[model samples]
Target chain A: MSILIDEKTRLLVQGITGGEGSFHTQRCIEYGTKVVAGMTPGKGGAQVFGVPVFNTVESAVRETGANASIIFVPPSGAADSIMEAADAGIPLVVCITEGIPVMDMISVHSFLKGKPVRLIGPNCPGLISPGKCKVGIMAGEIHKQGNVGVVSRSGTLTYETVAQLTGLGIGQSTCVGIGGDPLLGTNFVDVLKLFQEDEETKAIVLIGEIGGTMEQDAAQFIKDKVNKLVISFIAGASAPPGRRMGHAGAIISGNTGKAQDKIEALSAAGAIIAPNPAEIGKTVKKSLKY
Target chain B: MKIHEYQAKALLSQYGIPVPSGDVAGTPAEAKKIAAGLQGKVAVKAQVYAGGRGKAGGIKLAANADEAEKSASGIIGARLVTHQTSARGAPVSHVLVEKVVEVRRELYLSIVIDNARKMPVMIASEAGGMDIEEVTLTSPEKILKAYIDPSAGWQDFEGRKLAYGMNLSAQQVKPAVKLMANLYKLFHEKDCSLAEINPLVITGDDSIMALDAKLNFDDSALFRHEDIRRLHDPAQDDPFEARANEMGIKNYIKLSGNIGCMVNGAGLAMAVLDLINYCGGNAANFLDIGTVNNTSAVISAFKVFTADPDVKAILVNIFGGMARADTIARGIIEAYQQIDIKVPVVVRLAGTNVAEGKRLLAESGINYIEAADFLDAARKAVDASKGGRN
Candidate 1:
């Protein structure tokens, strides 16, 4: 079950004693990632590594039930700690804090309307499912469980496309960065409709870059609902066109945010097109010919 | 971030909108003493930061004050080319002399922030003084929109429902909904990622005004607008992206290509400018240096592409998640022992301390080149920018 999180994802950190939240909450508690609780508004009974902190994400989700939070809260208190983790219900918030302010993400998108919250990234670099779970500042020994889900927008180009799909053995069923901000809280068709309802994701990839239309709306939701093997890649395909550095609604919505207009809209909505950024994991190991 | 249309009509005549009586001038005798105290036809214009600028003559029209001092000496110190600039044009200096208004129609107004409706929209049009992407590609109901709801705010009926969906004139819809609610309070007290006016005319004494203004702001909220960063001009950028954004390396940028790469992560500096232009070379700039473990902002972005003479071949590309790799190999050997570079760099270093950042560049005696990843550092920085030595 590697989608938004895994291994019974408890998490919750929200600026837990600062400095990139106890240094990526001690590498998300050494990558096993249950992390539990931390908050730190007034340094509530502090403790960081052994977890338990709480100054309120409503007292660390009523004493550590936590249900997934993250947020290293800076950039002016990251939209009020993402509406205090969606009014302390935190059904996965994420936000690794990078530079908030797009009018505080349009007031955290009108306070996450119709909120049964999902949020994910104020600036980003936050999810992971490999080896069950991990959150935020990536590089947990370049991830590995297996299934190839990995979405992106670029936190170190999703750790160089998840360390070239865990060095070709191809392992991930969940990576998601969704950050390259121009206002975001999860996109690329909201994590490609959760990697098309992930059945331990058979194959996905997607990396995308250079100003939005979220990869032509994730190539029309992977050609009207993905059936599996995807690939994709874009990453500013040598961004050079009369580079007016972006948007007048891309000259009024013809959206030439280029990269061969998102590689001809994800190869005419069927996907599979890594064509360099060193062939994203050899175009998903030659399209799942694994 | 794109001001000048006389700093967007001096911040839209300080929020009460109605812009027109101008005054920005660097010669042509102060644009003929501001077009000899306005009144009739004037508008000299040309300020830069792209946009058609009256079909690149960078706007003109005068008639008095010695034809606005011969239209500010044919747009002060020439260089405008515009199909939104960069066929190496944009330099002009300053002009803006204003006072033309006599239109009677034109409408368009803007605002921005829609990022797939995360909201702040506005857009509006009446097929305005041409181009709102050709009125949404030929009258898509003459482009009018509204958005705003920042948790129930700015709802003066979303600027009177885009001034009654842009057909105004019920006494111009309450001063065009009080000039779009004081341009949404000067686009929310000047964080302004594009406020624009385009035409927003009406005039010939019917009042509406702002015949073209522009705005933009929000370079990450320009540190709470020091009065919109004193109308920042930095000679309209690209002096190596305003000296790599004055060395804090706000993602450096430049680009004409000679391979400069310098990564740290703006999505791995755009996948090292797309695998160094998909391995044929041509990257010349795009610095990134973020994910701050600062190595002196990577030795001031390696002295900004080793002081760019169209950089010959740099690369560097560090991954180092919390950035270590021997502190970016002692700031690229202290910027190759305090600059005097000549290009050919290449490096590569991966996440965290990659084998003590490749054994401190194989016990330094630096002639760099290392590679082994990112497609062998983009095919050895596109074969060291095609045999460097420039």
Candidate 2:
């Protein structure tokens, strides 16, 4: 079985009346996700694509038994939405909003400490369990039900890796975009632990970019505890130092978060390294063969 | 988003943080006047966005006012090519002339968002002036990190622990604690992503001074700080990048290649660039249209990409998961009609009424290549480039 989400997971949509929120909520419903309720602060009595809308997350959770919340709020309201979901006792919160202030995330992250709820992203594409449940803004048509588990910091890079895997006739158990912010709710090691425990996930593919020591920490985790066949690809191989490549988290500062250093660390930890994004799935397939 | 040392120090001084007396000089004459007023030795630092200026001969120690003037003349208009700066070199806009203090001890201090810990972290090290990475790789124990809770104020005990771990003297511990507290204040108040004081030196008479400071403001929070917005130096940035920022388009970095990529989302833009490189084609630039569904942003992106002489082929990849795929397609077609683009255009559209998007592209009759998957799109885009048939 996949981790975090499956067919049994009932979901709620926060900010569901917004254009993006309504559109993606409809897509998720069409993709067979159990979207029990939608929450828009003032539009409580309304319905979006036949899904019941409520004013507050607590009401939606209480009435529909929606255990998870997917937030489509804008950057300014993202932190409050996350906290509202957390306070409502939703088991998981997936925030698809990008460009939330770092200070806002600082408070959100600290508030999440020792809490039972798992927070996914403030600037990331949400996670998906292929063919079962979909959350966030990733294209549902590109994913397939398979055994390979994918985790990445980059949303489009995750899409590329998944598309390649689907092309190779390999499906993913779950694909998680942990977001590209400097302060992510979850780390590579946290996701690796879930992937390692999933029996359906025979092999895992990690797509990382330059910046941060998350890869190094993940490499160390794999070196000690992980037993699954893992293949990884770290982007920004030739990226210049100190320049932030697209994502706020993808900055190369000092010597801590270079691609070469990440590649070396992952390689030394017995993980196959795909130097290019195009070869990520192929490298994972090759690793599984051996 | 990287502010120069003079700007950072000026901000720090405004927040009551102790920094050496300094003035920014755009001309050699101004530098000489400032150097004359300062006692003893003065440090002339190049006011560019890049780091490692000292190694590039952009930073020089002047013994006298005449020497400072000479150093300023040498660095003011000269380009400094450091490992951090581009090969084209970063043009020196101004020079910061500051009083040189006699250092009794040097320490490294910074407050940055720690991803793994998911908090604002403070890093302190006894070894300063040199790179902190060298110290981390060789002897990680030299670096002491304190993860601060945003809800609670900067814990004095945490600062004391870090101060003791860094082997600070009794006289230095109080100021170090105060510095860490003030640094956290600056980090939160300024909405900074990173606030670093490399070589936070202790003077001979036991006063702590921020010798060099570097601050990177969070671009997302720029709307809140108008003062920080005024310090932006467009000359230190690429013209196209500055224009992209002004238009509210996010991703724009100048690369030395031939294929120009205009895509939606940061990750997709990077993946497209990576795919271009993998296919033996170089990407000239990275341009993300962000989340805008407007036609003007699309037209602006196309205009910027086509303006580059090195761009031989343009790749437009939009997944349109939340955004309407057909809207992007319409924008692309509208841009092609409005702008004069000489390069071959490769379009890839997916998600949320992709058929409609493809239909819009078909109606354009622009002789564009369409692909179903990312690989096909990347391959087709690369193939359209000169000598990329293989």
Candidate 3:
């Protein structure tokens, strides 16, 4: 069984009337995600991709019993959508919207603290339990139902690693894109905790980037608890200091979040380090002795 | 985006933070006029984004208006290279003329989004006029931090606690507390990624002032703050980057290399950089095409890449998630048709509708080299750059 989602997962699409919202909703439905409802403020009653739409998250949750929410609302409204989903007692909320003001996230993050709901991303690809369900925007064709669990801070990099793994016949129990934003709902440590506890996840692939203390912190967590073989890849090794390489979170500020520092931390923590993106699947395979 | 010191000071002054009266001047004569308006010795500061300007002679204490003019003439049109800047430093075209203050003590004060904490944190140190990171690395105890919970908001008591921790006197506490609170408010209200007062100086008259201001707003959040966005000085940015920014292609940083790499997602873009380097090639720039690919953006991205003379080859790596591979392929083909690109192009497409995207690339008859995977693409791009096929 996967950690966060499976065949039983009933999903809701926030901002379902919007272009990206409607598009991904249909894709997720095609992948058998069971998207039962959609939410748009003004055009609530309008149907999108054959899904029932409601004005408010609470009403949608009440009518359709949608347990999970994937937000495709614009940046300005994405934070409120997350709070609304959480307030409505949706157990999991995955925000696919990018460029939300960090201050908005600061308040939303504080609001989510001690709450029962689990939040995934403000700038992420969301998560998927291969063959069981798909959420957010990751392509379903590249995944296979198996034992390795994958967690990353990026979207396309996750796709790259997953595709390579799938090509090598290494199927995943679950793959979660925690997003590349600085202040995300779920961090590497948070997702790693879930992967460590999952019985089906025999091995784990952690894809991180250069920035923040999340990787180092997750390395500590892995050292302390994770029993499964872990192979990790940290991007931005060729990145210069003090330059943000696309992602709002991916920057080496002073000496804090350098690639070497993260690599040293992870290697010291008994996690096998993939030298490059292409080597990830092979490295994981070698470490798993398969 | 980072604003000039004068602009930051002006914004701070609006928020009730005490800053010395300053005005920016683009010419030496204008600098003299601005300094002539201020009393006592004036500071003629070069208006560039890079730090360590003082050591670079970008900042000078002018005794009179004539000296201010001389300082401005010496600074403006001159590239001031600091330790923080590239060897070929940013050219200074403006100077901020402000009256100097007598400092009894210097303290560091800044409000930054602490990524690890997932909250806005105020970092204050009794040790001032020095790099906070160095201070943090050395005497960590000297760095006092207070995390401001945005939902609960920052309390006056928390500001007062921060003031006390910075060792403010009884008389200095009141203004310091207010200043601290104002800084936090400005940081939150302005959507600032960083609002720093390098030397929050206590004057000899027992009053505190922000001697220096360095405010950086969140580039992504600039859509919300139109006024703050107006403060962005494109002159401080690389010319090509400024053009790219105006074109709404925000994720482009020009580097000094030969291989121009365009890829989807930041993490993967960076991975491509490493892969290029690993394959014995240098990357000319970092460009993330984002999650959505359209023809115009792709055309603009190609225009920017081709504009750089250092670029010898271009690599287009697309592993679509939310992004469609066919769209990326089509954009690349259309961009190639529109632009006169002399550099070799290596295109790798994957994810949604791979077969369709591959077919589109093949049908274009553009002689675009195809890569089997990420590694193949990187290797081909590097090989193509070296004028060889491997």
Candidate 4:
């Protein structure tokens, strides 16, 4: 009933032998996610947290029938790991590894065309389907199973919002951290489409940040398509206008990708804007007449 | 990741793409010497990371070696403040001294990764040297675009299309197309976020030359290109930021407010800034200690923040979402022992071992105030920023 993942999802952890990989793999397993297999090229035939390890994603998918993947590979190999997962027919791929090169992502995007895979992040915190499954680095205790779908570009901000929402007795169907890189696999519009279709997601909360056209494009998409109540929050309102914050974006995109501009866009699109990060859950509460 | 105009020109020339005959000069004498080699009139342009140099008086034309010396001498030590820079402007340690080309026509050519398209795109406009954004508004037809498919790569036809779209003649079309292809090659090979020729001029003799160049590399991809990394000018960054960069501390950006911030993760650091602003105060800087929470990094970050004269108070917020609060407390304690912090520090801890973290901080006798939660901490930070009692 939830979007992207559920209780039936079988997850594979890439780079399962590494420090972050082993640590978060245990965390994901502890969160009740079915961590069926792990992939670490040469370190196959091993088990971590009682999950079977495979040498390659293809074998991992073939043997364990792992349908979803969460990559913890370093920046250099993260892109190839994504392609390997996609090539192996893993329908859902979440890349938790941050700092992947933009060109590598562009190449991955091109390679992913006509493929069945939907990639979530290369520099993101990944996503979670509360109560049922978790496939990211988010603090598991903060999320509660409910109806509102949450998606954001920042990890800690997503946790902050989710913790706030959970405290307000507002649960989420699924929460996604889409990551904060220039070129990502799945953008706001792509995730928004999934949230809009999920029947469990009665309302939605979108958290965005400054610097990128994704929020603006998401606002336009929300204006044209979304039917449910949506509360939007954009962080970095107080961010100093450092170079490349938008100056180059100004020359090319005309839009500076500023907080005020994004806020106005969201508001004009009929999405109730949370004035600040601290007010996000309250704004959603007031907007939905809860 | 942003390289100076001279550096960008060097990369362009390396790829067989034509640029003005220029060499960067650290002194007026060097500039005069470079200009003397070019013989005729030369242009002395301030080598800075910002744009709008032409309009900002960062660029000057010198008819003789003496004039080039005067121009370089004027810009070398002075900060050239453009609309792109803060009011104080970027300091110019070097000037690009180059031969001036007679332009038969000016056109725009650039290759940037288009976020919306999720692919690399080539944008060209016949109406160059002017704002392409304005040109896109006034005459949308003037701005030509060729979206590159990463797998297939940039084709000769796409370059030809751009060259012809700029209304180049039959002979000029080939070289222009070649230049476009070379520029694309440079962009892809160098891992550049942006490779642009503001005025890709058709000279009086019908030769194509990049009169001005700007290249911005992907900061994340800098590891792959050591050659491009060598071009980085540390003098370009703020003193504190440069220090943080040297220490390998990621995402330590200086802001304009009085409250210095130290937080975990970029998202939370930004949220801290928002919470500060939302609480009726502003933050002085954005320092994300990252997920690792290395004690030395915290110490270095604290050192950087405390050194800023603009910072009146410090706020350290750690969500501890798989991170331990006691680790942060130890980091803070370690930082306090290593450095003499003159400002009030408000620490907010969440997640496991909060009591232990609190006890450790309280017993450490560092005088850091503790708040209950994010809001409480933000309020306390705002209050302390106003010189209020703990």
Best by TM-score: 3
Task: Answer with 1 or 2, whichever has the higher DockQ.
Answer: 2
Cα RMSD over interface residues, candidate 1: 10.5
Residue-level lDDT of model 1, residues B1-390, one tens digit each, is: 667788778777877887888788988998888788885778788888788888777889988888888878888998888876678887998888888878888988888887887778788887777778767877788787878777665777878888888878788889888888888888887778778788888887788988887888766677777877887889878788888788777756687888877777776776777777777778887677776564687788878887788877888887788777788888888888888787688888887879987897789888888878888888887887888432
TM-scores computed on chain B for all candidates: 0.40, 0.94, 0.95, 0.96
The superposed Cα distance between candidate 3 and the true structure at residue A229, in angstroms, equals 0.5
The C-alpha TM-scores of every prediction are 0.38, 0.90, 0.97, 0.96
Q: After superposition, how far is residue A164 of candidate 3 from its true place, in Å?
A: 0.5
TM-score of 1: 0.38
Ranking by DockQ: 3, 4, 2, 1
What DockQ do the predictions score, one after another?
0.28, 0.54, 0.81, 0.57
User: Residue A164 in candidate 4 has what lDDT?
Assistant: 83
- Model 4 scores a TM of 0.96
lDDT by residue (A1-290, candidate 2, tens digit) is 99899999999999999988998898899889999999999999999999999999999999999999999998888899999999999989999888898899888877877789988876889999999999878888889998999999988778768888887888999999999887877789999999999999989898888898999999999999999888998888756667788888887877678888998999999999876766787787777773
What tens-digit string does per-residue lDDT give for candidate 3 at B93-189? 8999999999999999998988777888888999999998899999999999888877777888888888999889999999998998889889888
Q: Cα deviation of A232 in candidate 4 (Å)? A: 1.3
**Candidate 2 vs candidate 3: which has greater DockQ?**
3
Worst 10 residues of 4 chain B by lDDT: B288-297
